[model samples]
Target: MMAIRDATAMRAAVADSWHRSAAAGVLAEDSCAPVTVTGDQLRDLRDAHPLARVFPLLDDVLGQAARDCDAIMAVSDEVGQLLWLCGAPSAMRRAERIGFVEGSNWDERLAGTNAPGLALRLGRPTSIVAAEHFRHSVKQWSCAATPIHDPIDSRLLGVLDVTGGDAIVVPQTMGMVRAAARLAESELARELLVPSRPDPGTGRGRIAVECLGRHELLLSVDDGWGQRGQVRLSPRHSEIFLLLASAPRGLSGDELAVLLYEEDGGSSTLRAELKRLRDLLGEDLLVSRPYRITADVTGDWLAVEAQLAAGDVAGAVRAYRGPMLPRSTAPGVTRLREGLADQLRSAVLHSAQPDLLSTWTRSVWGADDYDMWVRLRDLLPTGSPLLALAEGQIGRLDREIGL
Candidate 1:
């Protein structure tokens, strides 16, 4: 109470967080009510989120540390939405009473000043002991948390938290959470560094391309000295590479120009773009009787397509990052994006597991998809937290479409 009264005397981070929460109109005596998403919606959010990629690694580290302790391990996305929670049954039950469950929105603005929320807000490790929390209801608990970042770009990925009674306030607990976060970041970095296996008989070393969200090209020699860095492609380069990779026979300059620019210009523009691409990729890697990549490149989009072809709807959804070159308006790129999106959307709508449908609806590409949201809303159990989200979206969609 004294700390709350004289927040200036508190640790700078905690004091700042408290001040921010108050300015955001968070009431100290509020119930700290949870705004949660549950059931299929919860499962979907977890599956599609990039943070999901690190869960297995995080579980291996923090799960062991949490055993037999009163503390629980919680992970939240960059926005401070709780994604996963693990701990003793009794501890979990206690947590639930305070609405600290999976899929709950716990950002400082919503949940008041606390460790996970403050850690995310401050972009650093933080701790909040009992009586320091802005919400009176949460003051009985203590928590330590650290922000996790994407190793490649150093962008905040999520927050890792350990929460319990006063035990969580100890320095050792804060250290443990920070170490666990570092291990997770290391795992993410290692994944990016490793190259996928080369296609047989390609004879051009290991080639991997990511065209799902961003464009990245990686080539590793067969001699085991893999390239230490990746080449990022411009939008035009990405479009050209995707087309050439899809059609091994390749296209003539005129055909390529039409597909890329939506009109027939002479081969001059095509030649210039090709020249730039050649400079970025070695000249030998791109051949020109008809424009084509000399080597086979296994792409993230191709992997997703293969997974869908194998009737692995869940796997396909997992592989899909977003619409290919979402900002590109090239005719061929637009066709490919629409075709792939329609195919994946059909598969998810028709045969995806309930959880997968939820994921698709929550995804950036599918969030505005009305039919999927309707389907998910119907499938969710009555009174589920996600039902509200689906309903809200449906209502907005109804207004937009004049339904």
Candidate 2:
């Protein structure tokens, strides 16, 4: 339904306009500034201030969602720089996985012409596949973009996208984008708007959606009947649940398949899986047919799989509380587990730009980071110029604040 053409002209228009905005100072530099603190800042709060007390709810929420949506999606600000990703080893190693290596801006010549740029321009969901984008550099990559909105008022928040090989063109991509936006939207609301309510039903049992600690979400389900156990889905399912659970808008079958990779089979097999999930859960699920789904739908396995596959990682994670393969540990479960972990790690560890700097920093800190400190260490090296400069800055900060 979308057209691919005239990338050269489009690229020229975008570049000219971008330069004009920059020269005029109409584009805010702070817009690209991290809406966060480095890991060092958190460390200072712990060691120096103790009660210096700054909360990192947004960062955690973003981290968890990044982990959940690792399979087919990634997150970023209005610009096309990547903040999070899944299903790739590391952004540095992603020339083949993402079709573009790390740090390639959606607006830069590196990307040439791409959908991420167009989506930012359009301020809504848009797609650009191979050959249609402005740059031949990324002609092989397919992208789906969805703009997140402010909660309550529905103002433009940011954007979420999914990109990969030409294989990236799938219906579930829309669901992935929308679902991510929903989670981000929810966090924005919880931070800037109203608290989300617990919506529970009789036959469907109880569904409690809460701000986990302060940032990430925790969807705890109690069906009234049976013991109350948390759903423990795999990484792929967690990503899928996060997408679907945030659905004020539902997704389609093909769309869900793309996000969750269809749970070890083709789309038709996925459909069957959805039905079984629905049948098991009863009238607790809803389907968007060709597009989306939610927990409130009739939970036949087909519907279940559809919702889980479409970015409802929260639900799937919860549903998978038992062994990925309950009766036995099948090779299928092993493959699925590896996939899920990779997806989760992708979202949380990668920086917004997924640059060489980010990859190196993550590798250093991820093995053992409490939170933001790794980023602070990144500013310095052992006995290097940056290290000395950073130590001086820290000293100054301590003196200024009387630490």
Candidate 3:
């Protein structure tokens, strides 16, 4: 029997992982991570996972960067089973050689020492350079990973990882992964903080309109069946939908025209637009007389308001992606957007939780929010690393205003 190699030369964490892998009979020489779930089984688990809700957010934040850097970004469940992977096609092909494909279990006991497994095992951010891995095949690759947790009850949700060559082992890579993990957790918190009212009586399932920061709205609907799908709403249709949804009593053609158009006597044009909307949403959901959605509906802006009302200041900040229907010049939408933004900013300023505050400062909507930066500066502890970032932003904003 080959004696277990002396682990004195290894980092303490890696040594412990190696010891555990050996005890578990993981063959470091040429073993591979087991395929824990596949086909429909993997799809079902991913669909039901909380991370599924935030996968797009993670992809937006880190996917392009990973591709640009010749790396692949991977997300795994709390049990270390990889669910999704995105990056350059070449990088993905390279990763597949090492059995890093979706549905594979990379738990420390199974995959030996690896960044995602180590991070999940230690419940923190972890980086493993080439050769730090107990699995000989994975020695040529390096990775940085961080565990994402549900900010509500603090359950371990999953791990977000970037894997590639030596470039991925840098401290900045680790920092970026950690930041992405936090953003994912914040988004998850935002979802959990706001509870949507179910329309059990109507059995219409759930309808959500995502209108923040996008010209076209994304309409996600879950039918009474388990099936779910999304449709993109045009700017005019989205404005009409938001107005109708917000108006409990619904809006007549004349009322909608005023809110939807800048000029008077646009009711004829408004009627045509509503006709198109009716076709898209089906005639039953979009009724006449006073046009309204008969089905129960919720939206991102609504969720933000819900969080704010529940005193979840952090969640409100997270859910406030940007102004509602930003490109829409409709009087109703503009007013609604400004009002919701003001509420969130006021709450963030008054509540002043540093993590959420930092989240706000980094957002496109809040990048130049001088008052918020000042509030964040005052709120951060002196030794806090983010203190510098907050102060720097404050100075930048001050210079812009010629302070």
Candidate 4:
């Protein structure tokens, strides 16, 4: 068994992962990874996974190198279920001992910290060295993994990992893993370009504008190939995207200026910003006259609204990440932000679902919301252990407000 190091001595990511793992009840000693899917069920899952479209490319890119290095390559879906594993027979057998076999879940919460799970969690390339792993059983292995994103929606598709000994943790292996993931994404992009391919959803192309709780917005757009890519927009551009997406019919220059500026924003300034936004998005995506995105646009904030409209208060609570663009003071964004927060808060309070109210009150925007804390305190049944915690919070708030 490998010796466990103190959390303070580990790398920040690994330490944080260790903390989460422990919180999830993962044993520091050893725990078997649960094989959550198998046989027909596993087959169905693999076929439905987005990465299934580019499995061949992943194999062609990582297979030979894994065998050459006496390592094993594993592909996991977004949820960390091992969809496939390939390598030399010896390497495969070695990995199987630690529950790295196909169909076994390697999510950090399930199997303790690992490269694939951490990469999926952070959405980036990550490496886990011996002993850095949370489980003693997995400490002998080292691995490099990178998360793969869908080429059509920029949603996380899966993770590609190479697991072996010290050799796998080297920078070169990390680079190769990242490259393979990118190659898999490119292959997915090419397949979408097939003219005969059936449209999956939103035939006009889908645009996801992410701005809730974020100062800078991330615009995820489909490139007409049914493939998607993301770009970080400047704060001003982010505000524009939010406003335009909110008004599908479009917003005139004067209307936009009023929403964008505190006072007297010149037409040239708005035009320059619009032109730069146009440059970033291309001419066709952003049409002139009345500025609007010429695609099926949806914002994160809008998703919450849709959920609430559908009467899924729990779903709405889950979808509401935080106040929209919390740092933005722009008139339009501020109104949208407050309206969204108010709507969700009202729905959650009305539903009086203790769990939903708890989630809202725990959020940064709701933390200081006295009404929500009061609701949570009242809604929790008497003698429920959580009731005391809720009451404690109310007492704290009372003192803060001098009530």
Candidate 5:
């Protein structure tokens, strides 16, 4: 009791201390203790979310210390309890629902009220210090959240949160929350890419490879985990992944062997690579093939175009996750990058929705597309007010790094 009071009192007196503590990496150093919720209560929250299917991983994360770092780490839906358990154990277990995940009206109904919630609402990453929260209940809590984008469609997947108790309102836990959110994102990328059933709602076909997470987790999907973790692809294996993901109609073994640099063009190595890819991803990765190395970028482009013509906005967006052959480190990839960027720009120009258009604009950034984007922004109806209001955003981009 005294410890809690002293901590609280000291925190309030020199609230700035929390910021210092956070900057010093205090949270990472501490072993998180338990906070109150029961397994059953958590189970109840789990039942309320579609994501409950993945709650085991949530539990596994909170079971680690980033929890007690001054706050709790949790996952929630747009409305109501999803997985509300402790990053730490203790106190009591109350059947509680965080406001962030408590109803439809996304884009602020729940999100505008709090940190994690607001980040989700904005569909952008955000951080909130004490008093920044729009809701009274969450105002005292400091938070950091990142909007998790879908691996395939790049849609707003959800928000990953690290919330601090009182002291969290200070700045100390920022890094922890950001890191946790990133882990959540990496896992999301892994799930979307590494073998699984494809949801038609996503823009990609039954076997699409997201080019965004390419350098991130897809490295593992190919061979070495890169910074995302221990993905096992060697440099050669990486070449194979890019080919398959980029293939419009799926390649044959001979093509794959060429792509993989199989000396004799024997089907064996190509077949083996496919098997490994299948193991990492699920069986549906192959469109139809014995497997091919020579990806007909042109032949496969038809399917991608069909996605666009079919009015698949998400698919159009998904198709842009690129620099062409992402893993190759090849000089030839630049042309592919420029082509995809222009294509995405044209697609966004025609889209009816401002939000989607806004994302499209941000997705491809550079001098080449600068004037085109400026024109597109002007094209937005005067009545079509956007988050950045369309007019000013390009200037913001121009002032910053090229990308």
Candidate 6:
């Protein structure tokens, strides 16, 4: 087992990984690079990949094993994109803080020196311990991983990783992950021999609308080939789309007119706008008689709401980009904007993790939020690096309020 406290004592392979990570310009203190794929793009990648066939087996093996330990078992494709992660709920949450979730890229170029990335790079079993990790954000973690190869041709398939605290670097845990990787390879070989079933969800259009910040719409069609392009929306069309997205049960034209124009007088204008919107997004996507989005559409605001509802406040904060349609003054849009901002602010101020609070304080929205700053200041440890920023904000607030 490699020692976490001393880097000079590391094995030659581990030292070489650190050199490669440095050459890639990966910052030691920075968070992992931003997610490479999300939403529809991620779904399509997962569905089309050969590894998807072995997910159930991986889950059965890793999920059961992880329950008794404070670790997570992660599978990543050859390029180091995470395909699946399962572990103790608490450990999963901790991992997410540094962007270890599914669909994230953990390539050495992206996440710096880590077990999975290095194992894949070296084509062998590897271990990365605390402080040995190139990223400071992940120094608290240690992991062991091994590469899985295609059984027939011995082509590199992916990597299987077991990540946790200090226990991860222990010889027994390292051997266990290696054994699991071999088992996964055997399962994948068997699965490849059988004809695969068609995914029912394939070829379906996925519509994602973003109401936070600027209003935008993304329509991805699978077409049984692969995911395709996005359709941009006019601001007015985006407004209508948001209203319809909110009321999934459907909203009458009159009700929509009132929300859009704040009076019954603009029913004609509403109808005209609806006609144009229908022309842009296929008629089937926008059902008439009652104004509602017929196709499955997910909004960024809805993502935040869902995370909040699921009691994952950190996830909710991560999902919330900004206020809903920052430029829209439509009565309905304004209501949603304020309501969402208020709910998120309250949630964060009440129960946010310290790291999340630090993240919020750096944002434009929270930079001037005196109350949140006060709470964050109180929660921060004395002499912490962020204390100065929190104090500065509080002082600015005091001057503004003439305290």
What's each prediction's TM-score? 0.67, 0.32, 0.55, 0.56, 0.43, 0.50
Report each candidate's C-alpha RMSD, comma-separated, in the order given: 6.7, 22.1, 15.7, 8.1, 13.4, 13.3
Q: Put the candidates in lDDT order, highest first.
A: 4, 3, 1, 6, 5, 2
lDDT of 5 by residue, 105-178 (tens): 22331123344545654566567666544334444456666655544345554566666655555454556555
Candidate 3 segments exceeding 4 Å error: 1-206, 222-229
Residue 379, candidate 2: Cα error in Å is: 23
Number of clashing pairs per prediction, in order? 0, 62, 0, 2, 37, 0
lDDT for residue 282 in candidate 2, whole number 0-100: 41
Task: Estimate every model's Cα lDDT from 0 to 1.
Answer: 0.76, 0.42, 0.80, 0.80, 0.46, 0.74
**Model 5: CA > 4 A from native:** 1-127, 131-141, 144-158, 162-213, 216-232, 240-306, 318-322, 326-332, 335-337, 364-376, 379-389, 397-403
Show model 1 residue runs off by greater than 4 Å.
Answer: 1-70, 76-93, 96-149, 153-159, 166-183, 190-202, 215-229, 262-266, 400-403
User: Could you give candidate 1's per-residue lDDT for residues 104-132 as a string of tens digits?
Assistant: 87777657789898887778888889877
Tens digits of lDDT, candidate 4, 1-403: 2334587788999999987676555666654575656797689678867788888778888978998889999999876889999997898987787878998878786678999999988989999999888888888899999999867557677899999987676789988999999999998889766555445655466678877767788787874645566788888898988889888999999999999888889999999999999898777688878888888887778889999999988777656656777888889989999998888889988996776776566455776778887887788676543454466567777888898
Per residue, candidate 6 scores C-alpha lDDT tens digits across 1-403 of 1223445787777777776665444557666544555687568667766677777777787756765688899988766778788998999999998889987768775577899988877889988988778788899999988988867446576898888887556799888887877887888767645543434545344576755655454443222324344566776777788888889898998788777765555677788899998877666567787877777777778989888888888778766767776777778888888999888888888884665675566455776788888888899778554455467668767988999
The 10-residue segment of model 4 with minimum total lDDT is 194-203
Query: How well does candidate 6 score on lDDT at residue 360?
Result: 66
Between candidates 3 and 6, name the one with more favorable TM-score.
3
Residue pairs that clash (backbone atoms under 3 angstroms), model 6: none
lDDT, candidate 6, residue 376?
Answer: 85
**How big is the positional error of residue 251 in model 3, measured in Å on the Cα after superposition?**
1.0
lDDT of 3 by residue, 1-403 (tens): 1235768888899889887666555667754566656897689668878899999999999998899999999999877889999998998998887889998878776677899999988998998999888888898999999999867446577899999997776789988999999999888877754644543444455668887766767787655444455667888888988899899678888888888887785667788889998888766667888888877788888999998999988567656657888888999888898999899888988885765665566556786889888888898777554454566666667788999
lDDT of 6 at 325: 68
Please write out the lDDT profile of model 2 over residues 1-403, one tens digit for every residue: 1123333455554444334323322222111211222344324323332111111332343334334444245544433444444444442244443344223344422233345555666676777766555434445557777776545434343456666664557787666566656766666556533333544434445444432111222344555444243343433343444445544476566566655553454877766666654544343443445333433422222233454457654333223221222222333334444454344334333433223222222232232332222344454346331232233334444566687
